[model samples]
Target: MGCGPSQARVLSQAPISSNPDEFFPYQGSGPWHTSRADSVMQPRLAKSGPASSEDCPPVTLQELLKKAAEEKGDKLALKVERPCPSLGSDGGAPPAFPDEEWKAWTYREYYDESRQAARGFMKLGFEAFDTLAIWGFNTPEWLLSALAAGFAGGKVGGLYPTDTPETAAFKIVHSGASVVVIEDKAKLERLIPALAQRGEATTRIKAFVAYGFEPEAQQSVEVKGSAKPVLSWSQLMTMGKEAKDSVTESSADPLELRLKAVEPGHCAVLVYTSGTTGEPKAVMLSHDCMVFETRTVLNLARAHMGLCAQAEQERVLSYLPLSHVAGAMVDICFPFVATATTPAWVTIYCARPYDLKVGSLGDRLRIARPTIFLGVPLVWEKVADKLRAIGAANSGLKKKLGNWAKSKGLKNSKARLMGGDGAAPFAYGLANKVILSKVKAKLGLDCVKFGATGAAPIRVDTLQYFGSLGITINEVYGMSESCAACTVSTDQAHLWGSCGFQLPGVEVKAFKVDPADISKKEECPRAPSMDDLGEEYQGELCFRGRSIMMGYLGQPDLGADHVREIERKTAETIDTEGWLHSGDKGMITKHGMVKITGRYKELIIGAGGENIAPVPIEDHIKACCDGVNEVMMIGDKRKYNVALITLKAVGANGETPGTDQLDAGARRINPNVSKISEALRDDVWIQEVTAAVKSANENGKVCPNNAFKIQKFMILPTNFSEEQGFLTPTKKLKRPIVENAFKKQIDMMYSSSETYVRYED
Candidate 1:
């Protein structure tokens, strides 16, 4: 796990800032500097191994919550908001001003509520290690129920709200969850049909818990043929209270007994991967894995930002779907751990409570002003697009001033990359004080010191553009199996287009693969030594560490057989040696930074035997056109690569609207416009797309043999979406699904008599 000699050399040559605080391992005494064992937190396990005391802390969610309640009982732990009907309601309609109320819970109250829910589970005959499925948004109740399951020594699995009834039922049945906590009556109603469809397969589920509605409201809701009873949140709590009251002080509390029995290696959570190629596999993460990831992330953040006493002042916005590992870690695990160990941190849930304008993240940012912001590339892309559009719409002096400010910002960013502090230039002070400040305020990024992007590869130009604005976005790399813990770019050492160094306690290596071996599945080479590292060493990225998951549920021996089965279905694997073969073709730089090139399974092999990585081509095309949203390169065993492009639908104001808004508007314009391909017949959109592709082909970097120059392309009528099953929940393109869905369109491009419509360099 130690850094290689080359890595050491690279680190030694990195620039040292005059202000040491601005550099790595910021020279400041912080909470993390204190002995972790003495932080008044202890592992929940009764016994620890020799190395466990010093390295792996046997911590669990139950322990983290209990410690937080003990340390900061009266402090605000959560703020749940809900929209309410008006007092003088017109048939229970929403208020004129849209009335809303906030429900604040102290740490002790939250803990007590969790215990009550745990007691309720016990009354319903639930036992330790049982699975409880949670299906909802990032609500306070969702957190409470998840914690309750943990308190009862049960594992919790979350389902994406966007998942169809069939998909949700499949997970519920597959995970063997006996209880399901749903968002509301509507969500419960949606599940019933799927349950009936599933028949006996869903018989394992004994009960359904509903929230976001009154007890009377839940009583009216019914499942046609389900033997299980549906209960309201309050009813569950009431049941828990009654159960707790009946227990004598002489008897050990059921919740306490469950907590005591908890072990670090026990599966605490099941995060199902967004099964793009096939059925989703439930990734079983240990309590220790989650705790380790939290601590490691905290340590890195503190070192990079010099955050000593400011840990308490940090705030994070929880808006991403909690089903994803990134969302669960950020919104649940990080805050819980921080609250236990630091002076108190706040987590703000940004769902229905604030009457947040759908697709208007700008408004949410302004209000939250979170110190730490995490987003997928798509979110950042939209922000950049909006800023660019606003600047383009400006006229005369305003436009000139805006351009000057941007130029100065870009200059400052470049200066920082060359080892200077990212300070605004003297000539740019007026712009920073006026235009930039206003813009930051509007975007609610004024307080942001650490920004991160992950789940998908973002365009390098997009990252550079944000850096020019003085917001350095660290591109993080991880997967569901790692508990979303892997490489992360930091303020201390970051390179453009790289996913930075491996996380502490984590080890990564790249292996060489023969380009001609199409049948050979991507695997960890026998000799994965760093001595073999070179330009030609680029292959599959493999990682192993404490933060890695125990294994996928139901798959005990993750041997070659298991790996081969997974590859057969999804073209991904985790070898028996414990290294996760990421299937992602990548290379580790001398500096230890990892750069992902493309997916091995998704790589295009042309008829001429050229192996082309599609990602670079797609990114280049995207950089060249504002009108294009996504590009799927198609040329597997074909003469040359062609692309299926999805156009960005523009609003009446001449700016491309958000996907949701655009889809709605398109439906109104013409119902058939549901797919982006249908709208590709537009002459203007066609011209813009063709020009973008041509420009990419001319300017894009490519290997001698692996030329990514697109000979032809057809614009698609529809954009890929999670709802359409063409994308993962995290917004990554599902290659197999996309190809299958657009097979006819792909076939048309190859069969049509379109000649070499290529642009000359």
Candidate 2:
């Protein structure tokens, strides 16, 4: 719990401001530095449409921070809460974090410390515009380093904590990072040797800063064979503080000069995408891109939920992977903008990744009481499943009361979906007070005004399940290239399955293309209505705006070949007219709502050469089959489609399997079998699963034609997991890898004449 010297602490009696102008008064023309030619490409916009609104003018990270310091100086900016080590027993038990006190940092202290860290970078021979690669989980140090790099006129990239040593080294070398910030000594120990092995590739890394060390601890750690030592976080700050008075050949320290010389259009963040095929691509997002998105989100939130800066501020939990753009946007960029632009200063609570698993999340949520929350589909599914289990255990009057309350909640939410306030029913009010409110409080979601789901496909049933519990999980659609969001579902404009309307300033369209011959394409007309869309209008979703990234990272300095390679890759994504093709099949309504269907690459073609989207079909099967974890459709070039299903099982992390022991839901599917290994052989389990598949195929809503139905199916012994390289870091399935991994089982399913084949082990 003792991290180091406290950077800042929350004051018991900080003055509150009601006026926005008094809270943040700075407004100035910003081309602070000249645009550098270092970028391989710059952000491009369409021929017509507003790139940004006049209300939210473009600003650099430096400008934004400076303004915050000037106006919201004493406001709390960040807080880290962890259980006291002294209070927990040393019996290998988890820490009790519920009532733990948080260490806080005000805007003034945060900005000042980041500047010191920036000066520290200059002391370590860090040059302008160099990339700073961070390999760690969410923490104050991780955020500080990112801001420090931006202050030093450089861009920063994050490496997933779960990334392998080779993958981490590759990203470090590929980005040409001058410095790397690792979470702790343990990760540093693992990464150093791998970097050392790279030899010339890693020579660009002039220094390594180790975070999570005590303030008075050793300044540097020496590795066995390496000549250079890794500097501790405290040591980096000390260097920055000392460098404040030390003038070089120049008139002032390089920190101030870099700040003055950095342009808003320059790349500020590097998000490495985990592509299914090859090496991860480093997405270059500019300062303007991030700022534009932050401002736009604020506007949307204010319009929908009346989100504003006031005496009562918004609290957010930063638990998602910092490597992902959505996490960074909400946890990092959003807070800064909220503090600077409005009177309600935001407070960010940092949580470790482990806190996201099952029961641990509730502990953090109960403490943070965040106003806004975002989760992937898997996270929501687990939450709903957990609640379902708890509800099933209810007895006597509790069971009857719970059932009655849930029905009321579902009716209320469904009413809202049809343009009603959902508050007209007297029973609805009583239900919320008696049951739904208590349920929300227990989950630490009582204060959550906005809940969202994104990153991967989510089931409609899961969304509806949350609605039954009085939580509306708004769906959002975008990629890392679009700075996290292109379309967002809000309270004002929401449809259960839709991704919602396009952002105010952005332009979006669905272009028509044949699944077999995608190269030949044309722009499809928008549907006359939001609900009714013809098949002809369903096409590849595309968008363009100022929020779009500058370009993918390139190695132009290497030569013409590298330059050409960069151009080729860029052209594949962003067309000449600046529309960034999303690679997703979707349709846009005349009302501007967007509904994403599936990925073009994941489209399955049958023996009759009929185009079929597998995701919706897979989703339907999972929804129909209780205790089913994952349903993958396979029939790319066959007579009919088949499925590979994974049952819920006991796991270290709830989703990823650690043992074959069946979970409660899975066991309930067949009480005769207690383990997945046994359940696979049970005739009852197989019969039930077969019936579910039959139900899904016959449901006209999902599968309109016989060609789209899943014909044959087999249950996989294991789940598709990231640890097994069958899933991406975001929990998205690597379709080709999954198909290749189960080739034998898939072939066996098709070879058999039976409708449902049981693989003989």
TM values, all candidates:
0.83, 0.90
Cα RMSD (Å) per model?
8.7, 7.4
Q: How does residue 290 of candidate 2 score in lDDT?
A: 88
The CA-based lDDT of model 1 is what? 0.66
lDDT of each: 0.66, 0.75
Candidate 2: pairs in clash: 309-344, 310-344
Q: Which residue ranges in model 2 land beyond 4 Å of their true spot?
A: 1-37, 40-53, 82-95, 98-100, 196-199, 213-226, 247-250, 418-423, 513-521, 528-533, 556-560, 652-655, 759-761
> For candidate 1, what's the RMSD?
8.7
Q: Write the per-residue lDDT of candidate 2 for residues 388-498, one digit (tens) a residue.
A: 878887899999999999888888777666245535355887898889989988887887767888899899888888888888887888999889998887666567888
Top lDDT hit: 2
lDDT of 1 at 561: 65
